[model samples]
Target: MALPKAHRLKSRHDFQAVFREGIRRHSSHFTLRALKPAVATEPSLDTASPTANYASTKIGISISTKVSKRAVVRNLIKRRITAAFYQLLPKLAPGWRLVVIVKPTAAESKCGSQQFLQELEQLLAQAEVLNGHS
Candidate 1:
């Protein structure tokens, strides 16, 4: 379950209402964008096939078996990511569903927690989420 809304992005429909749609680069940072027609309407709403757009992004995290294998570790990653989101949402514009995929290093290393957070901070910064922190 998600933590109580720092401010709910609510549903994908709600996300569509404001989707600043961005993508994770090869570098793993998100790029910010304005709403496009593709970003605004659900495939069902759009009368089109459900082909995910690449130029845009959804914050989806992957905590793989390689990363944790343990349910508890995966849950920890989720909590960490959500906490980061709560702290950053004020600065994030609307219409994004963040999916944070956890790396193996995220759970196996002693310093993984700090590294995970730093990587998150980097991604959020690249996405411009902190540009308007308030």
Candidate 2:
């Protein structure tokens, strides 16, 4: 299943903001960049609800041609990444904008979903973006 719209970073501006302002965390397979969304900088105006105070995490996945010259491989990587994120969403901290960039090493690894999930979890932990982590 696809993630909800609120859980995705869809626009170029959003992606650029994350790239420009986010903190960097790296794993063997991917580099995770995350920025805690600022209160004043929120792009969405649907903030009157009490639940809106607790912003949902938004994620973007970028797989460049350098990682896989074939679009099919790149798309597969994207799907896997999204699936991994979906599994981890509830456990993840809220209000952060995240970008996961697949590295060449990741493409070469040809890891299965479980291994990809493990790598992603490790990256999230190191980035301190996961709940119950210091």
Candidate 3:
């Protein structure tokens, strides 16, 4: 299963914003970009709760053709990365925008899902975006 809509970053603008404003955390196979949500100066009347709109973390995955010429191979990498994110979702802090970009070296590596999970967790921790990482 894929990440829920609320947790997935689909807009090109959102991706660009994160790329422009987010901090970068690197690993051998992935480069993580994380942007903390902007502080709301005033509570909006449109929502009953002040924090309702920014209560979930949003993520995007980018795998370039340079990583793999074949769609199947690139898709497999994406799926593995997505699965790793799914497992770590609950531990991630809310109100953050994140993008996971796969490195070209990843395509030639023989790493598995577990390795992806470890690298992702390490990156998030380094970025201080994981819960309890303050």
Candidate 4:
């Protein structure tokens, strides 16, 4: 299954912000970019709750043509990566932006979802984005 809309990063600006300001964590097949939410400049309307606008963690997956010329292969990789994230969602911290980039070697290696999950968990922990990491 795919991620929920609220938990998926859909904008080009959001992805670019993460890529520009996020910290990078790497594994053999993937690179994870993670950024904490930016503080709001304007005052929130709800005076009673300062974090009313706080959001859950949002993620984006990017699979380049360099990973595979065929769309099928790239999509398969994306699915595996998404599944991995879906399983880990409950354990992740909130209000973070993340992007997962698939490296070319992943397609060549033909890794499975379990491998993706393990590597992803490792990367998240390394980036200190996992819950309880702080």
Per residue, candidate 2 scores C-alpha lDDT tens digits across 70-100 of 9988988888899999899988998888999
Query: Runs in model 4 with CA error above 4 Å?
Result: 39-49
List, residue by residue over 71-124, the lDDT tens digit for candidate 4. 999999999989999999999988999999999999999679999999999999
Cand. 1 TM to true fold: 0.53
Model 2 whole-model lDDT (C-alpha atoms): 0.87
**Whole-structure CA lDDT of model 4:** 0.91
Output the number of the lDDT-best candidate: 3
Cα lDDT listed for each candidate: 0.51, 0.87, 0.92, 0.91
The superposed Cα distance between candidate 1 and the true structure at residue 128, in angstroms, equals 3.2
Candidate 1: which stretches are off by over 4 Å?
Answer: 5-22, 26-60, 112-115, 132-134
Candidate 2 — which pairs collide? Answer: none
What value does the lDDT take at residue 11 in candidate 2? 95
RMSD of candidates 1 onward, in order: 8.7, 3.5, 1.8, 2.5
Question: TM-scores of the models, in the given order?
Answer: 0.53, 0.88, 0.91, 0.90
Summarize candidate 1's per-residue lDDT along 14-50 as a digit string, tens digits. 4444433445432232222323224535345644644
Please write out the lDDT profile of model 3 over residues 59-88, one tens digit for every residue.
999999999999999999999998999999
* C-alpha RMSD of candidate 2: 3.5
| Model 1: worst 10 consecutive residues (lDDT sum) | 25-34
Candidate 2, residue 134: lDDT: 34
